[model samples]
Target: MPVHFSLDEYRTRVARTVKAMAAADLDGLLIFAPESQYWLCGYDTFGFAMFQCLVLSGDGDLHLLTRAPDLRQAQQTSTLSDAQIQIWRDLEGVRPADQLQDLLAELGLTGKRLGIETKTPGLTAYNGDMVRDALKTERLVEASDLIAGLRRVKSPAELDCIRRAAALSDDALDAALAATRAGVSEGDILADMQGAVFRGGGDYAGNEFIIGSGEAALLCRYQSGRRVLDPQDQLTLEWSGAWRRYHAAMMRTLVIGKANDIQRRMHDAAVEALEACEAAIKPGAPMGDVFDAHARVFDAHGLTHARLNACGYGMGIAYNPIWVEFPMFYEGNPMIMEPGNAFFLHMILMDSENGLAMCWGHSTILSPTGVERLSKHTLDLVEL
Candidate 1:
């Protein structure tokens, strides 16, 4: 298997998961979140988009039920072998849940208290009902965020991946900035950025690369053909470096020409907010306190209405639709910060009145004493 971590790491993860399972009073854990399953045993595959499930019993059996395409996928990318896999045909009128029921029985999990992640894209409502109906169990607890909570804190091995991923993000940003000249289409600049990522041995980000130019800079997403850049245009880039599903997010803006007074003012405010946020993020600090720092800077500068409600969020193994993890940085979040926890802090100022977008931030990992910026990129606003 092309497992990313040592076998010992997987063993450690499973042991931790077992302890969590016990705390939740779960005899058998039915995991449909690919990240959770992969963390436990290096079982990687996009087959979670369809009907699939991994059964982890307290007795120490990791069983997977999946489609035919992932048969070899699990072998090459995951820890599961053929003996441990149960393939369910996708034939018409044949429910994959039937196969799941059979596997549950094989693992002696019939009617046992099963903890399942009910919120992942992997576990469809139809299939969830199928499994629930087939199991006839006494307790089926919703443990959607159970593994997510455990994974928020990174291990040393995971930190290494985040470090490399952060470097990859910086590389892409460097390339994109170098190519951002007057009269260039945003699409080409975006191509250069993503190309740098792949060439540097990084995987595609869990979400779309948020890049735009000029008026589109105020709008944070990619488009087919943004207006050509001019001498006084602005560009915004917000994307993550993905390595083995771990993400290190970074965001910044580039000005094609000399910035005006308001532009510089907005940029300064954003940078201040970012620094304040970094200072507040550390072990023992409340998660909401980080956002409070951000808000303080913006509110001080009279940009309260221009900022987002949230200043940051957790980042880890994520799939599309978004990359931000749960327990994000919003006002009043009571979750305490912990070491090894990775999160992104971006201060976005969409001053439509000024027709400018100045955003600045990066991903950081909390430490015992303070926070460490993952990327080497400077937080200063880029002026071309």
Candidate 2:
């Protein structure tokens, strides 16, 4: 069953967002992308090419302007019961600029600081120039970072959904490992993994399942192919499960037969790096410290050259949500690890000579004392 968040909870979240917007001195925000719309109103809609916008005023009023076909669907999914929904008739004739002008007039904001999601609208056919000319307002500013800062912290209900997603992913991966064997094709293993996720009541995988065998595993993100597995081949499987749009990812490597000394050494290094990264994920700890810990592990194993691919990202309602990868691996990101911040710490190692080795794990909640590992699956290398 799909978990439903309370209307009051959503309303409170929107209120907090609105307060933040007001503090940023923005009179209104225009959200056109799927992720922003879902974040603001808990509503997901199709037909993004149709030029839709959800206008959120500083005074806490919500108005959705979209094409005719999406009104019912938006209303059904939206948590704001009293939000007004409007529609435009034709793409060129209805003029998003003119409609936005009228919306601004209705909200009585003729000369106010208007904020726009520059990243989202920039990808679409809607011209900001047309809207600026129509409204005669020059207060449009980029609000991507501001919105992202607001969404970095997750609520308790959101964390629960993520935990469930992680559990399902762990279960599916265990089943996939059991089904893998010496004679199984890479494609067959991927198909079985997907089936396991579905049987566990998951809606979808966060990304495509990767089943790379032998030389194919040399690629960090090798996709599944028709090649049959051999007794001496090494296999790597990367996949995740989704529940109510939240994602939980897991990756594992296995040897069909006994692993060579080089493979075992690489695998051990990856496991140690993964453990070090996981240990550094407590509240108030610098995120850079976690990355540095992994880097040291790779260095200790004389695998510093392979450290470029050693990192992970944030996970959540990924398909239609913004600000998923918070505290990313960039220089000078001083965001501290908070209790509700979910992150994945992946230690991926690949060499042209030895093949691929990876250790992936995640934590949905970072407590004051320690962190909670969302997926409970063992990290040991499986022998088929």
Candidate 3:
């Protein structure tokens, strides 16, 4: 198999998952999340857009029920044997859920307590309804975060991928900075940024890069139009690097020709807030503490109205649509800071009064003694 992790590591992950299922008193898991499938057995495929599921019995038996398109995909990328890969035909009037029922029956899991992962894009609400109808059993329960909890703490091998991804993220910023100049189109800058990752043998990120300039800089999400930079403009960007599906994200707001007084002040507040968040990431501390620190710094600067509600979020092996991991840095979040946990800390301030935006962020991996900032780049505001 062309899997990223070793066989032993894969076995260990499966073992951990099965143990969790046992603790929950689950007879099996109807796993639909692509991340869970990849993390469990290295089943790499975007075929989850269709009706595909990986069924894991409590005894550690694995079976993948997917369409013909992903048959070879599972064989080439995952640890599953040919027999373990069950293809559900797309014939007219055939429902995949019925096929899933048959598959479960064959595995002696019929009417057994099954945990379903419902909080992922892999299982659309329509598909979920079909599955629920076919199963027709109250044994199915929501266990969306079961695998996610285990995934937050990165193994050494996973950390290796995250570190490489972080380097690629830094390189992308360098490429963007180098390409930035007056009269440059946002398309050209985006091309340079993504090209840097591809040149470094990196994978596509879980989501599109956020790039905005001038008035659009106040917006945080990616939009369709492209704009050329003015002589004096503000450019806000948020991007991530992916290696073997693991992501390390970063964000920044760059000044093209010169920065105004409000922009400079906002940048200073963002920097101070980001640093305060970093200091708050101590071992055993609540994830909310980091956000608290960010809030305090920004509010103390009298920019509370301009600041984002949340500071940051955990980052890991993510798929398309988003790269945000759970236990997001919001007020009152109780997720603990532990060694091997990777998180992205972003301090974003959008001042509509001045029509300006300032953001500073980077990814970090928590260590036994301290948190290690993944990016090699300095935290100084980039004035290009």
Candidate 4:
């Protein structure tokens, strides 16, 4: 039987996280957000409206407080056998927060310093205040930084999942690029790409694949429209294949007609920048250094100002879990490239007088010496 993360593994990871929280002087951590809940409990439920909360004590005790109907599903999926499950039915005028307060009191956490996940946007104002009022003796602290720090580095298991996702994404990009032609509509090309992902035993693309032609290609993240490709235009296709809910993205620019001198120049520049970025990826390499490499390539071609962000972030474990983005140009962020970290390297160059050209690739599992390009597509300009 194939197991993703065993119960023992989850318990060990949670123990480590809780020990870190205790070292930071937190008595107990309350994670009400979905990602945090899944991280700690290995229980994933759809919809943000579902009221599910995970509470972990400094002693490594775990508890799940949720609505009554969800209790069975939570128990079935969670790795924590000892997880105390609490169910509540809202009575006249009683909010879900009130139920959480009762659960906290039951756990005898009245006076302990409690840490709350502040990232969940759907937390109600009344619930926030109720938690504070209920735990009258303890101070409420935000644990976003503490949790994010732990989640940024990928584990070996996480890297493996992302590697599979990247492979699937690469296959999808190949199919999409192959299906693209002078007369094909953007919609048809997108359908072909998505179909490839499904046929390859992966789920749908995690995001909308942007299949833009001609002027629309300049829009960077443009969605596929009714526009049909012309022999003289360029088609830029951006998409990813999702496997086990993890996503890996790839983008490429294809010229429909014989490339003009200007188009060829811009494509070469973009490819050079992408290659430079790929070469710069290594453990302990500053993310800024990688960004500067791409920037320098564009500057040498006099298209520095015409570029969007040099590259984009780590992909794996689905940003659905924690939303950790590693932008190349993020100022003062001292995150060095580390082994097991996956990133998307996108090189975008748009010359107003000509057209837009882009090269997107995936790099998963950066090693001590270098990084791995998970994308298997040819980086050279593809002419349809």
- Ranking according to lDDT, highest score first: 3, 1, 2, 4
- lDDT for model 3, please: 0.93
Candidate 2, which segments miss by more than 4 Å at Cα? 1-3, 81-83, 90-97, 120-138, 222-226, 320-324, 330-332
> Model 1, range 1-384, lDDT digits (tens) per residue?
479998888888888888888888888888998878878878777789888888889866789888999888888887777898889997878888877878888888787888889888888888888877877753788988888888988899998888888998999888888899898888788889899989989988888998878888897665666677998889988988888888899888889998888888999999889999999987887999999999999999999978999888997888765777887899999999999999989899898887889988899988787788988777676888
Estimate, for each residue in 1-384, the C-alpha lDDT of model 4 and write its tens digit. 123576776776788788889888998888866655666666655533555568888888888777776766676667655348777675776566666777777787767788887666425456677766656666788886565556557677766767777787777777776878888888888777888888877765434677777888776665524798897888777677776556677777788878877777888888888788888777787778778888888889988767765466766544232322434434244677777667777777766665566554555557666777787667777788
The number of the candidate with the highest lDDT is 3
Writing each residue's lDDT as its tens digit, candidate 3 over 132-163 gives: 99999548999999999999899999999999
Stretches > 4 Å off in candidate 1: none
Model 4 misplaced regions, further than 4 Å? 1-3, 68-73, 80-83, 88-94, 120-138, 204-206, 222-225, 319-331
Q: Each candidate's TM vs. the true structure? A: 0.96, 0.88, 0.99, 0.87
Candidate 3 — which pairs collide?
A: none
| Angstrom error at residue 170, model 2 | 0.7
Clashing pairs in 4: none
Model 4: lDDT to the true structure: 0.70
